[model samples]
Target: MKERIRWMALHGFISGVSKLGARRGDPQARLIADPWVRENPGAFADECRKRGSLIRCRAAFLTFDHGVAHEVLRSDDFSVLEQGSNLPRPLRWIAKKTDPGLLHPLRPPSLLSVEPPAHTRYRKLVSSVFTPRAVAALRERVEQTAASLLDDLDGHDAAVVDIVDKYCSRLPVTVIGDILGVPDEDRPRILHFGELGAPSLDIGVSWQQYQQVQAAIAGFNGWLAGHLRELRGAPGEDLMSQIIRASEEGPRLNEEELQALAGLVLAAGFETTVNLLGNGIRMLLDAPEHLETLAARPELWPNAVEEILRLESPVQMTARAAVKDVDVAGMRVQKGETVIIHLAGANRDPNVFPDPHRFDIERDNAGKHLSFSGGRHFCLGAALARAEGEVGLRTFFERFPHARLAGSGSRRDTRVLRGWSSLPITLDARDAAMSSSG
Candidate 1:
């Protein structure tokens, strides 16, 4: 354990030196190049376990530059991470000013700075909207969107198409817009605001960006408030309308809760799904055999999506505050200490997953990944995200048949949310036979 700490500290020091533009002999790079890190990530987890229940550090395990403190996120220790003092101080500060009607209610309630009962209450009220039955209803709509988007690329001769921007990113946004009754003309504006609301791991929020985001939040709130008023007078079939009606009954969500719930549904619902689709497609394209295998047997689509979620989880990390000093995964965590749980790391743990680096569509146990998280804080939109992934992949391959990556891919800058900004790929219309087989 002492040697491991020294090794990690040395790696951190090396990373700092490299950042100063002082190139050292390829030691650090060579260390990373060692296959053991990828093939045996469990070694690190095991090392952490041997150290103690929890290791207090001012550094991050995922990246050396980031100051995120690490904590082991296990199903057994979920309660500690959820209600503990692990949430980054900055996020807690944001939670204080956060309008419950926006992002606050979607976060875990009580214990955290978020509203009491409101968060959990609101989540339960609208949970049904994202259930398998509800999300499954969007299949036809999602398929139509994919087909229409792909059809636009029919005449293009480009060998590679940017699936991230062209297909993966667009489908979920459109579908969520339809679910929430956002007007076609207003979808882009709403999407922009949603993107701004994405959680950030940075130490501080830019005042300018914060104000801009607040303005956007105000715009969405105003829109939702007006819609709520209308729903009270004459309810519609949309999820917002349902939420409005649900508020009037027992255990109702207040106006602030309504706004927060709607915004969360709009923001988290689509953003995560878009990344899931983008990452999933990129993974499949990288392994043409996997694509061919799925094309030959569409039954594997569901498991294939699960495998993709495991390999490239959209939500990389979740922050929680420790309510009390507690031991976790072998280290002592002091009260009020912030711990960042790396879902990506846990999902890829070798003990939990065999050959964790390889992308295998047939991996039966892939569903066990913590991509959507676990316990009370688990993603409410898991069903919706999965449905979109399955449908998007099925429709995309059915249409393009022979899509291949066009060039280098770009990723979103946000550390908490892992996704592609752009991924160019080429589609062959002539390979329509591949579509019919599925």
Candidate 2:
């Protein structure tokens, strides 16, 4: 009952407010509360942009304009809004009372929710392991993993396979598991936790889903505690072990902090990349012209990956709160106010890209898309995700040149993390198997 009440005070209450606002025709509310918006947000995003660069909704202000979104994301005047900060006093009290004490990825100490000084300390310790050189060194391993996953798909008697299950989801989790020193046997459980907890990043989840998310967090926290203890006793070459040692040498991370950081890494490391690969696979199959372009000019693979990010950002939107009164897009946003930065809309802003909806693998400025966000809070796994996207997609298509969508694929029932839950696909030219057998 306490957990139910707590869930109601936080996710439930906010979701109710947003749903009411959506019914009354608020663009930002519709964007958050409407499930259809998750699947087809372009229209709502356009409506928000049409209203103004910075506009108010019933609960908070929002922006889909690229420039405004960029400013809010990169500016020091704004910071990530702590969970329940925007809630009314009574609800906040209720939420505090029922706090689960689990190391939630959206709560403090996790890079996603914390502010500077602590965020700085935690990120500094964790960033060393994900440096460009470190990520680059893993590229060969990523390629090999991709090949192995494809080999598994090939060995299957049936030509049709769900890319999300068999390929897109497997590559990143396997690679990230290896990077984090998780035992091979434990990867599947982590993946399950990830799928359940993903909705925790979004607003307007059902009470049932919130319950499931909490349960997943509980499971992950328990598992991570044991894993971290093992690392502390005898560290390995993995990123988690390195982080453990680095913290001991400098500003030490407590058990809670270590869980927050490592949990975030383990979850964020693969979750977004899973979406990137799944989205990239669906997009490439839809646009064979670009695939042909990629095949002909293999060197464009990196930029092609960027284009995929721009066109279908894995993370659709994020929020930042004003630290002080600030002027944006010729309007004043007072302190304590929050603004949602619609990254998906910003990526499609016509001001930035010519015919933004059109997917062009050769887009020169595609890297400028705020898909990974910017400034002090830039995605810690950007390099790794890009490497995964480029390697995963390129290797899949290279292996099965005639791969095609077998049927209409189903998108995940998630608002924040956009990707397919099931992407049915047919691998290879139809007669290739017969010819090989002969």
Who wins the lDDT comparison? 2
Best by TM-score: 2
> What is the per-residue lDDT of model 1 for residues 13-128, given as tens digits with 9 covering 90 to 100?
33344334223322222223333433333344444434333334443213111112223332223243332123345534443443233433224432223433544666677774
List ranges where model 1 is wrong by over 4 Å.
1-54, 59-116, 128-131, 155-161, 199-219, 429-438
Give candidate 2's total backbone clashes.
0
The TM-score values for the models, in the order shown, are 0.75, 0.97
- Name the 10 consecutive residues with the lowest summed lDDT in model 1: 60-69
lDDT of 2: 0.87
Model 2 — which ten-residue stretch has the worst lDDT? 427-436
What would the TM-score be for candidate 2 when compared with the true structure?
0.97
Residues 288-360, candidate 2: write the lDDT tens digits: 9988988899999999999989989999988999999999899888998889888999998989998888889
